[model samples]
Target: MTILNNKESMRVTLKSVTVPSIPLAALLVIACSGLWFSSYWGARLALFPNQTTEIVNHLQKIIVPNTLLSEIISFFLTLLNAFLLAQINNKFTIIRTRTFLPILVFMTLMGTWNETHLANGSHISLTLFILSLFSFFSMSRNRNSSEQAFMGSFLISISSILINPLIFLIPVCWIGFGMFQSLSLKTFLASLMGGLTPWILYLALNFIINPHFNVLQALILNPNFVLDISTYSLPDLVYFALMSIIIIMGIVGLYSTAHSDAIDTRNKLNFLVFLLISLCVICFIFINQFVSFLPIIALVYALLFSHPLTLKQNNFHSILFIVFCVINLVYAVSKYILT
Candidate 1:
């Protein structure tokens, strides 16, 4: 009869490979590198500009497509965003542990898809939104955070100029402030002022540069309320479904472990959950229009996924993580190799 010993069991169990270890870090690096190469290869072979690229080109009066330079810029921007994500978690302890899992997960997700390889308005908007989050998360439990509120709203407004759909995030920020217990009449007014500042400046600049700039034409607020799944292949749909399942698991892990966290941490996690739901709703309502926002969605998804994959050390979660990695690999192969 064959029997398994403790050492052999430990070798098979993922709990033995904790987050802050060298093996996990090396594995993350290898996986991200492979995924990045696949995406880069795909983008190099074909550069397709979606609707968001056209809108951005029209608004800016400059054609910026997915070129080598744009791809490089997008890659660097993603790295910067990953660093900022890690910083947010470290500074706020949002994940309740000091782990680089967020960065790893974020970079891996960014590398998984070809659409994210191009430097577009969405990348710029996501960068600004993350910068704003630094201020928003910092305002926790501080009623006198009007300055932070203004800065946060200001950055978000600037991002909205790049991606009009993101303007909805202004109200989301207000709701987040309320959740953070930092909302006040003063902060509310400041946030409004901050949100309007970009538009005011944009209008003024357009007036000086060209009086017939047609602000209404530039600020197109069209929303096609359609569940546009026609663009996605069966494999793509399956990959998204798997990702959704992981996100659901992360949400469950978050709530199941909520009582162990501090009040501030709980509030922040709740805000993240709310923000993720809001993004999903926006994506669903305007999938065709907001396709560029996938990178932003990936950012939030990575953070949420990191919660469970980092904290929950069980056979189920471990197997889930392994499955997640394998799915990504298979999807990449199907996307870049098979097709």
Candidate 2:
């Protein structure tokens, strides 16, 4: 009985720390800023692909990697993403409570990954993807969802111009619209039109600029399906394995307690789960080609993971959260300081 009481007290203490408050938010900002600075300094440890798509190549020519301007842009974009994440949770109540834990988790994930400290096409694409979610979630049970569908798919189509593999998400978004009961013939046609509009405009612009330009070839998604796990360093492999475990735990926790949420909230959360799974598959298949998608993946993981971490008041979850934070710190130290 005494041991049980002590464990309960510990759980309560940890739960209080996880609560969303102004002081906690400020502290997180300071800590994440420090981490981001360290990551920027250790950017040399990141392994970038030698060759990339023509669009990304063009983007790099403008952004110019390893520059202070690029790092500053990336940092501000991360902050913007954190703000958007908090807004998404507050607007939709996806976590069933008003909390900033998603922002905390997301910033921690972003700061730990050295590769994300540089401005890239993936950063821009992720911002667009999250914006699309705002439109997509608003379409739940909305009778006139054609406009939202168009806007959402239009944003995603623009994102695909940067990260070509993201084009596959259009079908996933359509399936999500079906789950939300907002998929009608009109909305379907609108989404289809929205998905094609960007490509059409890009093709036309390219034709006007250079009639011989091969826009179709530029749009092709050439994913390297080979799983080259052996290429990763020991620390990277361990870090990735830990992240995979956290993802599995979050998914299991979500399904275990999903019945408690409101129907609307549940449907929205289900769409997130479906979208997260689809993104994971895309990442797995195209990891070599599109590692920039990590920030987007981290965004979804933070949302799903926060649900159970913030709500579950058990000692097991509290301990898990503590371990999660410690692991992130250690990984950051290993990459940025030790290396």
Candidate 3:
């Protein structure tokens, strides 16, 4: 019985080691392939947009070309992204447990789907933000120094915008990522260049696809740009409000945690605070699409900070925060195109 159990354990460990590499490569192939389709089709809903929709519509545009170089490149980028995001946990305090992966894969798939599906509505502006949130949660489960944590964040932000340039909004994280990593200026510039490289390619591709590139249109910044918002139903408003309340409480938790005397957790808590502030600014400057991006980041930060707030401490504020998310989600049911 012991020998059989040991054999099973060894097989499981070996398989676990090998499986992530292939699926990770496959995921990036699918994600990058989604971008290729985006170029050809323009981000649009043919008939289905939801993840719950038929798999054919969602996966149809993703073509895994079997070329060696393309596959290798796809594989490497995905590995780097995943490593920056989740590999720290195994490397540091270095747990041998296999539980972290399912959640990681789930988020990767959902996040990629969100990025791809929403490309038309909210993808471009929120690009850096959404990817940063995904990376934050992925790394939240690890043991990393302040510097390592910062670099991980920086690289993720820089890497995210490589696919979508509008992500330049999270410059704070890119800067912080570099600073936290204690990287030399050359390495920092190299990563920054890497981030912008995709956008440069995007322009070249634009020229190839359309000879007379609308240089003026691409460069023009509306001096008085305002978002165009459609009407929202009552339920949509409710859900939006509920989501907001939950977020505020989470931020409050972050503040409480950051001020702690515990030196160990201060830096991470502070990092979360920095992320929240940056996210808030993006929400203000860019678009309201940032609301959904808030809850998860806040929740993850709350977990890291772990400052339990009692109703006695601030009853009214706590109640209001919880109320907001409920109202917001309710509103979203009727008003939102994406759930």
Please, what are the lDDT tens digits per residue for candidate 1 over residues 1-339? Answer: 012258456322343333546776777666686677666556434344344433466733443445556666777778788888888888888888777767876887777776666536777788999999998988888888889999999999998877777888889989999999999998888889999999899878987888878877767767778775787789989999998888898789878888888899899889889998999888776676555677788888888777876777666666776787788878877876555
Considering summed lDDT, which 10 consecutive residues are worst modelled in model 3? 46-55
Residue pairs with clashing backbones, model 2: none
Of the two candidates 2 and 3, the one with more favorable lDDT, higher being better, is 2
Candidate 3 lDDT tens digits, 145-204: 333334434544443332222354346544444334433554445446644555566567
Give the C-alpha lDDT of model 2. Answer: 0.81
TM-scores of all candidate predictions against the true structure: 0.89, 0.92, 0.45
Q: What ranking of all candidate models by TM-score puts the best one first?
A: 2, 1, 3
The runs of at least 3 residues in candidate 1 whose Cα sits more than 4 Å from the true structure, single-residue gaps closed, are 1-27, 42-55, 58-64
Candidate 2 residue runs with Cα over 4 Å from true position:
1-9, 15-17, 42-45, 49-51, 336-338
**TM-score, predicted candidate 1 vs. hidden true structure:** 0.89
Over the full model, what C-alpha lDDT does candidate 1 score relative to the true structure? 0.76
For all candidates, the clash counts are 0, 0, 22
